[model samples]
Target: MHGTVFPPIEPSEVISTFFFIVLLFGSFMTVVIANRFIPAVINVSFVKGYSVICLFIAIWEMISFSELVNPVLLPPASRVASMLVFLWSIGFLQSQIYATLYKLAYAFSLALASGVTLGVMISYYSNVFSFIESFATAARVIPAPAWLALSILWFGIGSASAIFIIWLGCFFPIFLNTVAGVAKVEPVQVETIKTFGGDKWDVLLDVVLPTAYHHILTGSRIGLGIGWITVVTAELASPDAGGGLGWMIMDSRVLLDITSVLCGVSAIGFLGVVTDSLLNSLEELVQTWG
Candidate 1:
């Protein structure tokens, strides 16, 4: 029997490959321009590091497609690039992105509101703190995935379940950090406020809250990260409810389409970086105001 032979690459495949190369080149050039002309406005080191990582990955993908590595198990970067383009063209990727972000926003907002409020109450009243601290500690120790079964049972396989998972993942960090920050507010500051004829409400609003803002921001950063992870996990577990990046990943895995899986992973990582940077900027502004 003749050995199996692959067909020659088509013109469209060549064009797609060229487009991918151009895309990478453009990204590299953008980084170079930013570093050289806008050094003070950007994180030059981070941009450089990211460019190097992308270059390394592109080279590795080229090597893989040359048959040095098993492309069947780890699809080449060109394949991933084509898959991303296809997803974007179909509008499915955008919808999934929106769904995930919408759930994250809702869950994180709920976490912020409840966490801060309860945290302040706990910090102010010894009785409330005593009643809740042990429970909060226990909840914090449990992994987010541990609650998935119960969340699914209660909320079913949909946005409600995903949001609940994200909320649980985000809540404890914010709560704990706020409690710590409020507790650390100097007694002298509170006394000074009281001496100025301020009541408990005024003291809380004028002193404790402002002092704890930094810590609360830190908690929010941590919670956002956790929420991102939890939402993806929940979507992966319940892909049929609301198609998301995680659902795309699971579907790709089932088909052994490693390229699509990688694309999904990249999308998640990119979103995380963007969101974290925005939060960091907001934190800086808050710090300046404080």
Candidate 2:
């Protein structure tokens, strides 16, 4: 009963969620239309012609699997819609989304801070960068679940473990990107700045650093993504955090709750898409400046 309240299956609420989802998707379509379709119609560029294609996919998912999917194993889209509608009516929709976001926030904050600081230092100082880069490479190659156990040992079984897992999971991409960005700064730009009485920070600010902004941003974005992935595992491994999306997923699986599983999957994917889009916007801004 507490489980029902804790990680409720509100696939019913997804019906109302259409207001948010469809409107957002419509905005994306508007862009595709503006960027690709409109120009092509004016004989400027080739149209993507894929929005309608995706719509067709929705149609096929509803029709093709409606009766084919067993209720226990794979609920119909209609059922998932019903569950969404149910959840939305109770006002638990936003909370459901928040559950996942909470874990991500804890994980990303640490990884970004560590990665950027270390990356900048390494980029400017070759010796320091080599040592840090070597360690980051080792950490990245290690299995994430193993680190979750280690984190639990160090930080208990709740947010601490989850945060540590996420931190370790995302550290590599950000660190590597930062180092690469620092190392790849244009030599001529550094010289140009140096010739103008620029000190280390001035050269970095005016010349060397700007060149690597794109790479740095890319690393940070990837780190955020990996952190999300790691939190799911961490939550499962940590007994006390039996309230996160990962735990919610673990519980749903125990009860054979396919719709809830799908719901969690959808929510995570939604967040990921939103996050990537925001990062891309930042990257574009950096490029404009760079």
Candidate 3:
């Protein structure tokens, strides 16, 4: 009887794997050394957050080593990390990330521009809003993902479809927030501007936009979060997303490569965290400006 044969690993792969192993071990050691020197490090919010991550990794490692669950279903964290490193080394991961970000950027930019414009029009001209309100309400009632089928039909199974889905997901929150912000501006402020010889431009520049800026940003942040989720969903469903983390996950799943799937998931999580942090910083900056 012939036993199953495995492909020979390349020397470069061996070197890369060894390097990643050393990095992982060095990271763990650094954490341990830091813990020894700074017992109160965990008291800091950032450190506490990382501690939770470490705890999760520790639990996952234990579960993998203990074989309490099928390894195929839940691969070890090390394997996932190594897979991520290997993919990055091959430049495949970077291309996927770029594709996803490019689609997201186009979608969210369109949503922001149109949402804010329509929101302003709606806020200023109640008649226009009255005409559009019912339709808007009906559309908003439907979830973003529900539009996937129609998006694919309309735009076909490519990045266009994914962009449409993300735009749909991001538009409503931004529109609603802009309307709410504009509406919240006191009528007295508008009157005051007009009474002081201010034109419509003055009302818009001095009162409306400044008042609504924070709300718009808040809505943008919410919309962006939704966009990320929608983009991933679209990529998973639409085969012609070109390439993306979502596509990577789907491909890995089909091949039963759980480690690559986890790597994709980790990439998404890392991107989410980074983007949210940047948005938070922007929000704070706006607050300070105000």
For this target, which candidate reaches the highest TM-score against the unseen true structure? 1
Q: Score candidate 2 by lDDT.
A: 0.67
lDDT of each: 0.83, 0.67, 0.83
- Report lDDT (Cα) of residue 194, candidate 2: 83
TM-score of 3: 0.88
lDDT of 3 at 267: 96
Residue-level lDDT tens digits of model 2 in 1-290: 45442234444333433454465467556766676646654332322344554465356345535556544565655456566566556766567567667767766777788877877876667764467656666767886667766676788766767777777778788878877787777788888878888888898677656776777788888787777777777666655753666676677777777776766676677778898898898888867865
* Residue 263 error, candidate 1, Å: 1.1
Error of model 3, residue 248, in angstroms:
1.0
- Model 1: number of clashes? 0
Put down candidate 3 lDDT per residue, 1-290, tens digits, no spaces.
25522112211332333454456557766776777788686335555566677667767866875789876688767667666777888898999999999999999999999999999988889875687888888999787889999988898877988899899999999999999999889999999999999999999989999999999999999999999989998889877876799998898777777777888999999998898899899889878988
**Stretches of candidate 3 exceeding 4 Å from the true structure:** 1-43
TM-score of every candidate relative to the true structure: 0.89, 0.77, 0.88
Q: Give candidate 1's whole-model lDDT.
A: 0.83
